[model samples]
Target: MSTISETYTVTGMTCGHCVASVTEEVGAIDGVTNVAVDLPTGAVTVTSTKPVSVDAVRAAVDEAGYSLV
Candidate 1:
């Protein structure tokens, strides 16, 4: 299988804890292999084995106590 990557915008992340939270939750999603968050730009890049669900991503962000914008 090939890797699928996506970038999403997130809001309300203020520090490293927030970054770790988002990374942990999103990285837990099935098939997710890598999660890179750019705090300065509020950009989250997710690399997975397959196309991930928007709803799942939204939920993961929510679990991290943040909003995906």
Candidate 2:
């Protein structure tokens, strides 16, 4: 399988807990191999084996009490 990486901006993340929450939620998505959250910049990098939909990522962020910008 090929690795795919995508970066998305998120809002409402201000600390380490926020980072962890985003990571856990996004990482739970199917095909997701890794989730990296940059709290200072609110940039989330999702690495997966397949293309993950934007809607899926948005929903995951929402589920974590944040918004995908």
Candidate 3:
């Protein structure tokens, strides 16, 4: 399967725990295979086996108490 990566600017992630929360939330999506969050940069990278919808990612971020910028 081809892997897809997406970079999203996430807000309200001020600490490592916030990053972890975002990571767990996004990583729970069906297509998502991996996730990385850079707290300082407010960037969240998601790797997936299939095309991951931006709306789904945004929803996950929102569920995690963060916003996609």
Which candidate has the top score in lDDT?
Answer: 1
lDDT of 2 by residue, 39-59 (tens): 889999999999999999999
Q: What is the C-alpha lDDT of each candidate?
A: 0.97, 0.96, 0.93
- Sort every candidate by lDDT, greatest first: 1, 2, 3
What tens-digit string does per-residue lDDT give for candidate 3 at 1-69? 789998999988988899999999999999899999889989899999999899999999999999999
The residue-level lDDT of candidate 2 at 33 comes to 99
Candidate 1: list runs displaced more than 4 Å: none
What RMSD value applies to candidate 1?
0.6
Steric clash count of candidate 1: 0
Residue 10, candidate 2: C-alpha displacement in angstroms: 0.4
Kindly give the stretch of ten consecutive residues in candidate 1 with the minimal lDDT sum.
Answer: 49-58
* Colliding residue pairs in candidate 3: none
What digit string (tens of lDDT, one per residue) describes model 1 on residues 1-69?
789999999999999999999999999999999999999998999999988999999999999999999
- What is the alpha-carbon lDDT of model 2 when measured against the actual structure? 0.96
